[model samples]
Target: MISAASEVFSHAGKHSQDEIALILQKHLKVDSAGHLSNERRISPTRNQWKYETFSPVWGAPEGLNSKFAPPIDDLKSIRGVRGIPHQSLRSVAQWINSKIIPRCHMEWIVSSGALWIVQLDLEWEETDQGKDPADATMVAEGLRPISTASKIFKAFTPGDRTSWPKLKNLEDFDFGTTRSGPRLYFATAEQLQQALATSGPLLETEIDELTAGRAVLRTDLDRTDSGILNLPRTDTVDGRLAVAWLRDTLPLLSERFGSLSGLAVILHAFLPARAAAWAYFDPGTPIAYVDALWGLPDGLQVLPHDSFQVDIRRGRVISQKIRFKPRFLCEAPDGTWRYTEVLRLKGRSQVLSHEEAIEIGLRTASIAEKLGQDAQIMWFVGIPNAYGVDANLPWYRAREKAQQAPRSARRYRPVPVSKQDDLATLPQGDVMIRLDPEAPLIRDDAFLDEVIRIAQARKLPVELQGSLLSHTYYRLSNGGVPVVLAEPYSKYFRTRGRRVFGKLVRDRVPVGIKAGGEHVSEARLASDDALPGLFAKLVEEGQELLQSSDKDSQVEELSDLLEVVRGLAFQAGAEWEKVNQAADRKRETRGGFQERRVLLETSLPKPQADAQLDPREIKLHEFLRVEETGSFASVPIAALVSKQGYASANFELDGQPLVLTLRLSGSRIELRLEEEPSDETNQGDLFSAA
Candidate 1:
C-alpha cells in the first residue's frame, strides 16, 4: 500500500494552510505575533531523511524523556497511542545531545495520556547527508518514527484528514502575501531609508515611461516629508522595484483601505523540484487522471503527454499509458527553467512508479471529495517528498450538444479526387497487388499513391492485399477496390468478413459495387448471439499478437480483427458509418488509444448501497439483525454501512453500550468490541463467536 505521508505533507504546504495553522496552534502553541509558547515541544523543521522519515528532530529529553510511556512499534500504531517507553525517550535525547549544534524545539501533549512528542525540530549544523538520520535513534530504540505531527494528530483525532485547498482570514494565517498600493508610505522612517539605500540608477525604459507620466513627490503632498525619492527603474532587480513600489504606494493604499498594520508580509522560500505532476478529478465520469512531466506542470495541459486513469473511490489505477516523450521541461544550472530534449525518454518510458501514481491518484480523489466538486492540483516531486504547489478548477468545459441532435444517414460515394488528375479517371482493372509480409510496411499516402499510379499505368484492376485498416484507408483516399485474402480463413473470420465486407468478399467482386447485397443482408439478419464471444476471442488474439515476435502473425491477427468489430456492429443493427461516428464521439470525450494504455489492475470498491450490497455485508447485516438478538437487534441500520471494508455498530448490552466493529477476515466475519468492561470477553473470542 502506498503511504499517505507524502500526500499529507504536500497538501499541508499550500492547499491546506489553515490545517497547517491548526497544527501549529494545537502542538506548537504559536500565537498571534508568531510567538511559540514556553511549553516544551518537538517541531518538524521541513527537513527530510532518506525518503522514509518526513522530519526527525533531536532533543526529546526536555520534551519527553524523563517521563514513562509505552513505545510506538508501528507507524500506524501511533493511533490511540498516548506515550513511549522511558528508554525510547532516552534514546531520542541521546541523539539530540550527540549533535554538536543542539538547536532544538519541543512540545508536550496535555490531552494525550502520556508525554507524546507531536513535533520535532533539530539543528545539526552539518552539511553532510550522512548526519541526517537523527531519527535512527527512535528506530534503534524499537520505536516507530512518524512522518509529520499532523499524521499523529490525524490518527488519534476523530476528524477527516486535511485534503483540499481553502482560503481563510488572518486568524488562521499560517502564510501570507504582499499586495502593492497606489502611493508609498512606510510604517517607520527606517523602512523608507532602507528602500532608498537599495535603489539603483533607473533604466532608459523606466525613464521614458516615467517622463511620459505625471510626476509627484512625497514632499509635494507634505512639507514634512523628504524630497521626491528617485525610485529604481522597473528594469532593475525585483527587490529594488518592489521596495520602490511599496515606498510609492503604501500611503495611498493606507488612505483608501484604512490601517495597514494588519497587513502581513510574507517571505516564502522556493521549494524547487525537477519534476511535477498535474492531477485532476472529473466528477462527471468520477475518475482521477494525472499528467506528469519532467519539470513544472506549467503549460502541461496543452502539451502532448502520458497519463494514468484511476478509480476514484477504490484508489486503483484502471489504465496507464506512456507515450513517446521527445522533450521535457526542467530547470537550468543558472536557475532558468526550460524544455530540453531528452532522447533517452523519447521512447515509451515510465516516468513514475506504480506506487507514486497510486498515491497521486488517491490524493486527487481525496481533494475532489473535500472540495465537493471537480478540481485539479499541481504537484512537485523533489526527491524524498512531493509538494502541492497550486490547485484550481478547470477553466474549460465540454462542447455543448444541439438540442435536437442530427441523425446521420449512411451513404456510399466514390472517393473524391481532383478532376484535373488523369490518374483519378483511370479504369481500375483486375490486378491484385500482393503485399509481402517481409517487405517494409510503409503506410504513407504518397507512397501508396505512387504504387497506385504504377498499377494505373499498367491498365490493370487493383485489388489490395493488406490489413483491413490499410485497405480501408486506401479505399477512403483513392476509390473502392476488392480486398483479396488467401483462402482457408478461420470459419469465424469468414462469417464476420461476409457480414462486414458485403460484396467485396465475393469472388473477384469489388467493394461498393452493390449496396445491401444478399450476402451482407443475410449475414446481418442471421442469429449470431455468439458475435459477442467472437469479439472477445479476437481481442484476446490481438493481445497475443502484440507479444509475438512473428510480424506475419501480427499482420494476420490485425487483418481479421476489424472484421469481428464490423460484424459486432452489424449484429447490433448499426451501420458501419454510425459505428465510426460513435467511435469519433468517444475519442473526443474519453480520449483515443494512440498511446497504447494498459489496465494494470482493477481494485474497484465493493458496492455499499442497500440495493447493491456485497454478499458479506448482506450476510453480516442479516446475521446482526436476524441471527443475533438483544444489542444487535437495536443497532442502527445506518451504522452498518461499511467503509474501508469494515463497519461499526453502537448498541447497549447488559445496560452498557459498546461499539462492535465488523470486518471481513478472509472468509469469516471478525468482530472487535471496544469499551467492553468485562475482562473475560476477549476480542479474539468475539471474532471466533461471530
Candidate 2:
C-alpha cells in the first residue's frame, strides 16, 4: 500500500491528475479507507504519567506496538472500509496514536503489513530518530522492559504572520473596497465592563457600512479593564468567523454559568478542539489545560524559535515556528504562582500510553528552565484525570447535558465526467449543464429526477460538492464501509466537470460532472431528506443562476432563489415580511443588483499567477468555513476564491480590457485576479495595469 501510495503521489507531483490516476489504477489495488479522526486530533504533549490496565493485546507488524497504532473507525460502520485485511505498519501506528475508540470496531485501513513485536521505550532524553525502549524509563518499575521500538511521525510549519498586516482599528480593514462583504468589530474594555454590569451582559455592534449583510458576534464576555481577551491568531476571514462563534456561543453561555470558571469549563464542553486552539493565546489558559498553569499570572508570551529541538516523534517542527511559553505558569487559589510541565491525555483512551508525549513535555520544561524561568511540571486531560484533580470542579457548566450538535460528516457519491470535454450546454436552473455528443458515458437520471422532485417539494436544493478536486477516486462499498482507490486529477479536469452521478461501478459508461479537489472521497450532494445540506445547495444553485447570461433562465432561477431565501429566513427565525422589509431598507442605501455591475478595484489580495501570493492576498487564518480544512491546502488560491459565487466580470481598466474576477472562496472579499495574465499583450498584473 505504501509503495502504491508513494508511486501515485510521486507521479501526481509532475503530471495532470487524471493521467497519473489512470497510471496508478493500472498498477495499484485498494486496501481500506474511511473518515479521518484528525478533526479533533491533538499532538501529544507532556507532564506526569498516569497508568491504567492495558487492554487485551492485538497483533500487528514489527516495531509497531499494537498498543500505539493509528485509530480504527469512529462511525458504527463506514461504507466499504476494507479492501484488504491488513494495511501498512505505518497506518497501524497512526491508528493507535490517534486513540480511535471501541477496539472491537478496529476494522479498517490495514495501513501496514510488516509483522513483528512492537518494541517500546521506557524513557530517555530523545533523538532525531526512533527511541529504544531499553534505554527509556521503567514503566512504574515493574512492567516488562521493551528491547526496542520504531516510530513514524509528521510535523508542520507555523503560519507566517508578516502578511497579517497590522490594522489598528476596524476602519482600516478593507479586504476589497468594492467587494468587502461582512465584517465584525472588537469591543472596548470599558464597553465590556459596562455590559457585564447589566442584568444581561450584551456585546453591542458599532453599526457601520461593514455591517451591511454580516451578523454580529455579540457576546456578553467581559474582563477587567487591565485584562485583555487574547484572540487566536487569525487573518481577516478567520477573525470574522471567530466573532461569529463568539456571537452565538457567548450569549448562551452567559445565561448558563454565573462564574468565570464555569464559563471556562463549558467552553471546553461545547467546543473542545477549538478551545484547545484558543488556549495558545488565552493569558489565563482558563478552560483548556486547567491547573497546568496556576498563580497570579504575569502575562502570556510565545517562545522564540530555536528554543526546542525536534525528534522523530516530535514530527517536523520548523525552526522558526513560534512556541508559546510560560505555558505552565499559573496561580493557585492561594494566589501564589507555579510553573509546571503540562502532560495532555486523551479522554478516549482507557489505558493511556503517552510516555513519549510526557517526555517531550518534560523536555520542553527543561528548555524553559534553561531560559531561566522558574516553572514546574504537571498534567492535564480533556477531562479530569485518574488522580481526580479538578474532578469536582464545575467544568460542565450546563444545567443539563448539552446535546452537542452532530458533527458535519457529509456523505459523498461519485460523479463521473459525463463528457470528457462536453461543449454542448443545456439550461438547468440558469447555469448551463454541459454534455458531450461523443462522450463515453450514457445519461440516465430517472433515479436523480425523482430525488430532485422530492427535494423541490421540500423546498431544498440538491447539494453538490466536487470530489477531491486534485485527485479522482474510485469508491466502492464492502461490509458497509466506504473504500477508495485514488489517483491524480488535473486542475482542468476539476474546473470543467460539474454535477454528479450515482456511485462508481465497473465498466460504467460515465457518470455526471467531474468535481475535483484534493480529497479522495466522491463528490457529495445531500439526499432528498437532508435539509441543512439542501440550504447550501439552494444557495449554490442561486449563484449559478446569477452567473448565467440567459435572461429567461435568470428570471426563473431568481424565483427559485427567492423561494430558497424564504426557506432560509424561516430556518433563521425570521418572517418573510421582515426579511423583505430589511432588504428594502438596505436597497434604500446600497442600490439593488439591477445592472450587471463590474467591480474594478479592491484592497484585497490580487494574484497575477498562482503562487506564494502577494502577501496582501495571502490569509494565514481561515476566513471561510471551507478554509478550515487542509484538504485543499495545496489548491491554488484562485480556485479557492472561484468557489465563492461571484461572476468573473469583464471590464476596462486604464483603457485596457481586463477581467476583474472576484475571489469568492473565502467568506468575504479576499482576493482577485487583477488581470487575466494569459492575454497576448502583457504580463498579468493582479491589480495594476501594464
* Per-candidate local distance difference test: 0.38, 0.28
Cα misplacement distance, residue 34 of candidate 2 (Å): 26
lDDT of 2 by residue, 1-690 (tens): 788778877878887655443322222232333221211111122211111111122221112233433555544332333333233333443544455331211223322331222223322223213222112221121111121111110111112121111111112212234322111233332333344355221121222122221222222233323222222221112223434444444454445545333122100101001011101101111111111112111111111001112222233221211222212322222322233332222221211123323333333333233434322222222222322222111111101111221111112222222333321221233121111111111111332233333333433222211111100000101011221212112223212212343432222223321121211335444444345644654645555674778899898878766766666676567888999899999999988987534343456556784543233343322333222232222233334323333333455557775554444421233335455534422322432442
For model 2, the stretches where C-alpha displacement exceeds 4 angstroms are 1-535, 546-549, 595-690
**lDDT tens readout by residue for model 1, 86-188:** 3444433444444424445444332333334555555443422321111111111111121212110112111223221111111111111331111111122
Q: Per-prediction TM-score, please?
A: 0.25, 0.17
**Positional deviation of residue 446's Cα in model 2 after best superposition, in angstroms:** 46
Q: Over all chains combined, what TM-score does candidate 2 have?
A: 0.17
Query: Cα deviation in Å at residue 621, candidate 1?
Result: 53
Best by TM-score: 1
